[model samples]
Target: MSVENVRPVQSNCLLEVCVDSVAGLECAIEGGADRIELCSSLELGGLTPSAGFMQTAAHISPVPVYALNRPRSGDFVYSVLELDLIERDIEQARAAGLDGVVIGVSLPDLRLDIGALTRLKTAAKGLDCTLHRAFDLVPDFDVALEQAITLGFSRILSSGGALSAEQGLAMLRHLCKRSSGRISIMPGGGVGALNVPQFMALDGIKEVHGSCSSPSEAVHAKVTALGFASESSKHTDASKVRALKAALLVPSSD
Candidate 1:
């Protein structure tokens, strides 16, 4: 299996579950997630979790937790004020004793904003960093991969520029091989227990990310009517998390 820029698996695949609420956080741990990506709104593709949420997770989670450092919704093209907020949030995650921060910033032309990322990375020094899905938005993954590695990102959560990991398997596999083991290329987006086994054997994969979420049992009719919540809401499901963990043990063709 020797290949250019590729390495052997150093360890078993780790399950990283992304969560928005305290309940989701609890469920992720309870379901055996090796790590947690703390954020505010899954519906918005994950925003920075509040200081309070980080604090709560610090108190509640036994496993390592990383805060998503996105300041707002829309694009990854952040403004100066938003960058300020993101830096503050990175400090907050460290203050809350969280393990790391997930971050990404993009240019108008959809390239990784190197200057902005360098600043954020400086602020997040001494903590782990995961480059978020904004990597998928880049025009060239090979270029972005080099930039991300140089910026000191410990891992990257991406769906290979596609809507789902299954649909982007070829690119994802290439990224894994290309990354070797210099930086972890974690496949995510529409990932779940049912299909996790498929990703277990990539050349440089060491971790995988998923929401492990399901429809909220009681979507409170009144809450939706008042526009406080969407009628079709989802929450982290402990069973899904456990299933994903179990799935990771299976061998894969890939």
Candidate 2:
């Protein structure tokens, strides 16, 4: 079904599955994901996907696809040249008819780079803009949350500055309370069927993100022989995605 045709779950909470490959896209769709974040290397915390990958995935994906806009790996801070490149990529994502773009920029002090973020949002004028996990890198969560809201991000993907949503529940809850409907605080990182209920129980959380990924031996064998690939090229498992989605849709009796 097309994204427009897919109905929201009874609970009204959204499930966003992060995927790096077309195979993973198919799995997410088959498993009834509410949305998909398209990227290349999830191991490096997700890099911008190629134009071809974005186009192909957009063409076939049943749900809306949001492209990650980071130019390179190490940090959220970008040089002028890198910012230009990121702008170009955002345009490419728009041209490819993607539903949205995920992006973030921070200073050395680990604060939101408002200037860069403004320019990037301008470049992505028509697309939904999600502030990615770069929120987790910020030194102050409250200040960063206000900054993201001021920058007009549709949502902020975060793990509460912790390694996983479970680990950061306190901060996540605080963000939701402070947001007060001005912005969305979407908890990501290590969210799964096993722990989604804990997040769902939070008062203001309306969305969640996860890779729902499982190791694929076939994928491992294909890349490991190249002498450079680690056993980290995982694919989204449809069954796992289904379980996660099912868990979110059902109300917790506890």
lDDT of 1 at 118: 98
Give the local distance difference test score of model 1: 0.87
Candidate number achieving the greatest lDDT relative to the actual structure: 2
Model 1: lDDT of residue 101: 91
Off by over 4 Å in 1: 1-11, 250-254
Report the lDDT tens digits of candidate 2 across residue range 160-215.
99999899999999999999989988999999999999998888889999999998
**TM-score for candidate 2, residues paired by index:** 0.93
Candidate 2 RMSD to the real structure: 2.7
Give all TM-scores, in the order shown. 0.93, 0.93
Q: What's the distance in Å from true for residue 176, model 2?
A: 0.3
Alpha carbon lDDT of each predicted model: 0.87, 0.88
lDDT of 1 by residue, 90-167 (tens): 999999999999999999999999999999999999999999989999999999999999998999899989999988
Q: Please give the TM-score that candidate 1 achieves against the real structure.
A: 0.93
